[model samples]
Target: MQKLYSQGSRLDVSMPVIMGIVNTTPDSFSDGGDFFSTKHACDHADKLINAGAGIIDIGGESTRPGAALVTEEQELARVIPVIEYVSRHHDVWISIDTSKPAVMAAAIAAGAHMINDVRALTEPGALAMAAQLQVPVCLMHMQGQPQNMQANPEYENIIHDILTFFKARIAACIAAGISFDNLVLDPGFGFGKTLTHNYQILAQLAQFAVLDRPLLIGLSRKSMIGQLLNRDVEERLIGSVSAALIACQHGANIIRVHDVAETMDMLKVWQMTQTQMIKQN
Candidate 1:
């Protein structure tokens, strides 16, 4: 079993945990503008928590491909209220999905338990800010900026390159005073990869455990599932849940997803089967 410590709270990853996605942006790839307001976002977060989500990931800016940049003030306004509301009402963990140092700090002050940076904290001052916050940080790997990530994504060896990136980021985080137990790693699917690259990462997802950090995978209703199954965003629920089950089998520790209830149901069944297998063995 692996344990992740955040703000003096502990999360046991003996089984895969669900990190529910709550996009407060107007242009996210899926469910954008659905929870744009603080009340709506908090309501959606309540549903996710009721549905067995262990973490609620609140994102202000959309990092979707071809997405534009949002100002720091705008981003803060979008997410801080939601974080405050959830923190005040619920006892669940809150993860702030941002790559900006200021946003990270503000979110932490607003009662966020974790930092989920799509840029892997490569942005200026992000690493130091996370270290200073002393909370669990998820470092995701993206080959390029959000605006042009998918324009022409390429890699000599996708898995190797991602592993190398995680290694360097882990070293940087440690040097900046973040403890190893407070770190999580995410191989950014759909961030800067072709269909082939995305599938390749999924197939070899377990290899990431070598980093000795919890792995967070976000594959809910993504273009990878849509493109593969010929389904639209709203129509990709089955594919999304199936992909999440596959990720759990491949040793994903945290599954970041849009369909929280469905994913939690699948994980319950998967956990039951694993327990049976262990007993039989």
Candidate 2:
């Protein structure tokens, strides 16, 4: 069994887990316009909790390719209330998905348990805020900003680039007084990689375990699956599940996903079969 993940609160990372995505955005490529209202967001959070989500990651901004950036005030307006509502109502762990330090601090003040920063806390002064808050933080690796990330994806060595990025970010977090166990790594599946780069990253995930941090793979209904199967966002459940299963098999500790029920069912069945297979072996 692996060790535990203390993202905000302590998570028994003895086994693979699923973290459900609750997008408060109006333009996310997947599950956008789905959980936009307070009532709807709260309802969706309940559904995800019932579906076996170990954590609920709420995001206000859309980091989708070429997605417009939301101002700090706008982002706070969008996510703080939702985080507050969930924190006040639910006993489940809450993850705030934001890159801005202002929003991160505000969310932390609102009782968010984790900070899932797409920039890996490289944004100046962000690491300090997270350290000050003393919360678990997820550092995601993206080649560039969201506005022009997909314009031209080029990399001499994708694995090397990702590792270097993680190393720098992890070092910064450590220097900022954040505990090592409280830090998580995200490969940024669809942040800025090409279709080929995305597949390559997913296929060779073991390379990332060198960083020795809990790995998070958020490929739920991402463009890589959409391109692979030529399916729309609504039609990519199986592909997303398959991708998540592959990621877990290749050493991913957590999977951030929109399709919580299906992913949870798959995880239950997969775990049971793994137990049987291990016994037979």
Candidate 3:
């Protein structure tokens, strides 16, 4: 059984946990303008909680490939209200998806329980700030900045490089006074990988488990699904859920997704099947 200790709360991750995506930005790759408003975002959070989401990941800025960056002020304005509303109204854990130290501090103050950074706290002062906040921090592996990451991303060996990056980041987090148990790892699918590269990581994802941290996977309706399946963002629900189930089978602990209800249903089926198999054996 896996458990993540957050600020004043505990998240049971023994089963595959769902971190529902709530992008409050207007330019998100999928469902961009759908929840850009605080009311819409908060309402969506309510729906996600009811649909069996273990965590609500609220992102103020769009980190989609080739996406423009927002100011700290803009990010704060976009997410704080929603975080506060969710925290006030729901019993669910809130994860702030940002790499800015200021945004991390502000989100936690406004009621965020975890930090899900695409840049993995590589920003100046981010590591120290995360240590200070002492919340469960998910360190992701991105090859380059979002704007140009997909332009011509390359790796000597994709899995080996990512493993190296995670090792270094884990060390850095612990050295900065962050508890080893308070860390999570993400492979950053589609952030800087080609279609082949993405599948390679997915096939070998269990290798990351050797790091001894909870593995957080975000493969929901990403371009990898769209491009591979030749489907649009709105039409990738089935593909997204399929990939998510594959990731869970490969030992993913936290499955970050946009379709909470569908994903939850699939997880229920998977869990029950596994249980029945164990009993039979």
Indicate the TM-score of model 2.
0.95
Clashing pairs in 1: none
How far in Å is the alpha carbon of 161 misplaced in model 2?
1.4
Over 130-247, each residue of candidate 2 has an lDDT whose tens digit, in order, gives 8887788889999888988998889999989989988988888888898887888999998889999999999999998888788888999988999999999899999999999998
Q: Candidates 1 and 2: which is better by lDDT?
A: 1
Residue 189's lDDT in candidate 3 = 97
The best candidate in terms of lDDT? 3
Task: Let me know the TM-score candidate 3 reaches against the reference structure.
Answer: 0.98
Query: Candidate 3's error at 230, in angstroms?
Result: 0.8
lDDT of 2: 0.86
Number of the candidate with higher lDDT, 2 or 3:
3
**CA RMSD of each candidate after superposition:** 0.8, 1.6, 0.8
Where model 1 places Cα greater than 4 Å from the true spot, the runs are none
> How are the candidates ranked when ordered by lDDT, highest leading?
3, 1, 2
* Per-residue accuracy of model 1 over 1-281 as CA lDDT, tens digit each: 89877766778886899999999999999988999988899899999999999999999999999998999999999999999999999889999999999999999998999999999888899988988899999999998898899998999999999999999989999999999988999999999999999999999998997888899999899999999999999999999999999999999999999989899889889899999999999
